[model samples]
Structures are given as structure tokens and as C-alpha cells.
Target: MSIPTQPTDPAATIPAVGRINWRAARAMLISEGRLLARNPGVVLWTVVLPVAAAIILGSIPAVRRPSAGLGGLSFFQLYQPILVFFAITLLAMQALPDVLTRYREMGVLKRLRTTPVSPTLLLFAQLTLILSVAIVCMALMVVIPPLGGAPWPRNPGGFVITYLLGAWAMLGLGMVIASLFHNAKVAAGFGSFLFFVMQFFAGLWWQRPNMPVWLRDISDYTPSGAAVQGLTDSSIGHWPRALHLIVLAVWGAATSRLAIRFFSWE
Candidate 1:
């Protein structure tokens, strides 16, 4: 007796076979942009808070203790980058979790599942939104502060380098948070908690190098710490800027890999 073989359908046989529809992706992006623009709370947290924090925090006589030739720089100049950092951090963490939860609840992801939308592409879309916000926030951070007489960056190249690296590092961190938590509440809570904790180590409250030995050691390894170092190095050249770059890149890569592996559409 001879054994029989079954034929396969080329499309059905490939489990992960689908190219993204750019039109669909573009539609998704437009929808996301509209949603972001319409949400008052999102606007408050993403835009208003950072500006308030920078000015409010910088205004505090205590917080204005200057270093790194900061005496020569105006108060707004010292705090401008910090404001952009806070805004980027805030937006990146909130974007994915809120969007994913709403999508899952609304059947957006489910409907998309039937199409050629890859998980990676969806992730990329979220990143693009965050990047847009970060860029805008950064522009505001750079431009608006100057209106208040903030000092211009002495080294524009260094400033650009720091902001780009730091933003991506936070973006990756946000993705990891979104992947780990299933519901919007859990994701939001975790993201918020981690944001505060990271901000502490990111030199928001105090310089990382001045922290206790154990804390300093931990800060050296965390994404926010690396980001703080990178941003600070843009003005004050203590460590080789390359080391901070490497740290941010490593965090971005590791967290992103973990996020992709554990991410769930549901």
C-alpha cells in the first residue's frame, strides 16, 4: 500500500503571512492623532504638566541651586530639557496602554487581526505617535524657554544626541510596561509608579552620583539613570558620552525585546 500526501494552500500554510497595508496604517495613525488631540486629560498630562513642573520646580529657590556652569545659564535654560524629558516620559508610558486597552475593549485589535496588520507594525505606530509628541514637546521645551530668556544650548549636537537617546530609552521602557500589564488600570498604575521611581533616580529630586552607594549602583543600570547621565553630559562632560549612549541603547533593546515577546493583543 502507498501512503497519500495532502496538498497545502500557500496562504493558509504560512501561519504568520501578511504584509501590512500602508493605507490601513495611515488611517490608524490619523485616528490616533485625532484621539490624542481631543482628550483634555491627555493634553493636560502630556503638555501642561511638564511645562508646569519645569517652571514650578525651577522656580523653587531650593531646586534652583545651580551647577555645570548653570550659573551662567538662565533658570529656564537649566530646566527646559528636564521639562521635555518629563513630557516624553509621561506621554510614552500612557500612549500604549491606553490605546491597547481601548482597542481590545472596542474590538479594534480583533478586527485588525483579520487583516494584514503585523504586531510589530502596530507597535511601530504607537512609537511613531510617541515620537511625534516627544518631538513637539522638545520643540516647545527648546523654543518656549527662550521666550522667557532661557540660554541657548552651547552645543546643539550634544543636545540633540541626548534627547533622541533618552526619548527612545523611555519609549522602550513604556513598551515593557504595556506588555506586562493586561488591563488599563494595572498598566497605568505600574507605569505611574515606575515613572516616579525612575524620575527619582533620573536626577529629578537629586543627583544620581550623589546618592548612596547601593542606590548609585542601581541608578547606573536603570534606563532613567542612563538617560539622566546622557542629558546631563550634554552640558557637563564627566563620563564619556558614549557610555551613556551605550546604556540607553542597551535598555532600549532589552526592554523592547521583552515587550515584543510578552505582548498580547487581547
Candidate 2:
């Protein structure tokens, strides 16, 4: 007797299992982008708050006064970098981690693993959205400073380099946090705590130039602190100090490697 063979499904054969599914990835990216656009918290943190803070600070007469310590730049001019750093911190620490952990909690990443489209594509989409928001916020920051008569960066190229490096370091740290935390609530809480501490070191609450020598020394090593210092240096026409760039590069490389190694699909 001959054995009966099961028929293969033509639909299944059309989408090869091991191939990259750009169509699926693109669809997922569009969906995630729409969700992100509708998130009130993301809008508040990444867009509205940064711009509002810059405008408010720029409006202050005292802050507009040129400071001898700031290389004759006004307090508002010096604050431009801090506001940009704040936007980066908000997205990288608070927003990115929360989203990734939520996906894990919802089993979204696990489900995606069964398809030809890798779950990593979703992560890339989210990062792209966050980076776009950050760029807009940074541009707003640069524009607002000039509105208050604050001078633009003297070394624009150096400023761009510092900004990109700082963003890479912070985003890498966020990825690490997301990879480690399974619970969305815990991830968000920890991210917020990190955000505040980094902002403190970045001099959002106090002027870096006025900080005690030891404290300033310590802050310079922190990612946010290094970013602020690098941006400030570049704003005045100097290349960021080798030390600051090194710190940022080290953090970016180390945290990114750790995140990739530890990341879980579910």
C-alpha cells in the first residue's frame, strides 16, 4: 500500500521563513510610529517640555545677561546645551526603556520572533522615532537660544559631533536598561531616577562653572556631564576635550555591547 502525502500550503511557500520581510517590517514601523505620535507622555517629554523650558529660560532678563565665566555668553546661551541634553535624557532613559519593556511584558517581541520579520526591526523603528523627536527638540533648542540673542555654536561641526556622540551613549544606556528590566513599571521608575540624576550632573539645576572643583571633576566623567561639557566647549569654537569624547565613546560602546548580549525576546 502507498502512503498518503500531506499537501503543502502555497501561501506559506510564498513567504520564505528565513528571508527578511521588508513589507512586514515597514508595516510594523508605521504602526509603531503612529502609536508614538499619539502618546501624550512622549509629546510632553520629548517635544513640549524642552521647547517650553527653553522659551521660559530665554525670557528671563537675568539669564540673558552675559556671564564672564561663560566666555561672555549669556546664561541662556550656556543653557542651550542643557536643554538639548534634557531632551536626550528624557527619550533615551524614560521613553525608550518603557516602550521596550512594555513590548516584552506584552509578549509582542516573542510573537514577532515566530515570523520572518525579526523583533529587532521593531526596536529599530522605535529608536528611529525617538531620534527624530530628539533632532527636532535640539533644533528648537538651537533656534530658541538665538531668539534671546544668544550666539550659535562657534564650531558647528564640533557641536554636531558632540551631540551625536552624547545621544549614542545615552541611547545605548537606555537599551541596556530595557534589556535588563522585564517589568515596564520597574523600567520606567528606574529610568526616571536615572534621568533626574543625570540632569543634575548636567547642570540643569546648577551652573557647572559654579560647582565645587571636586564635584565638577566627578560630573565630567558622567555621560550627561561629559555631553554638556563637550557641547559647551564646541559652542565656543573649541573641539570637545579628548577626555569628554573618550568618556562618551566608552559608554556608548560598552552599554551597546551589554544590551545586545543581554537582550531577551520575551
Best by TM-score: 2
For residue 191, model 2's alpha carbon misses the true position, in angstroms, by 0.5
**1-266, model 2: which lDDT tens digit per residue?**
98877558768647565676778778888999889868757656566877788878877788878889865867876787898889988899988999999999999999998876789999999888888888888888877767766677888888989999999999999999999899999998999899999999998887788888899999999999999999988887899999999999998999999999999998
Candidate 1 residue pairs in backbone clash: none
Deviating ranges (above 4 Å) for candidate 2: 1-20, 59-62, 69-73
lDDT of each: 0.69, 0.87
The list of candidate 1 runs beyond 4 A from truth reads 1-18, 55-78, 236-240
- Across 170-195, the per-residue lDDT of candidate 1 in tens digits comes to 88788888778878788888878887
TM-score of each: 0.80, 0.88
lDDT of 1: 0.69
- Model 1, C-alpha of 56: deviation from truth (Å): 6.7
lDDT of 1 at 105: 62
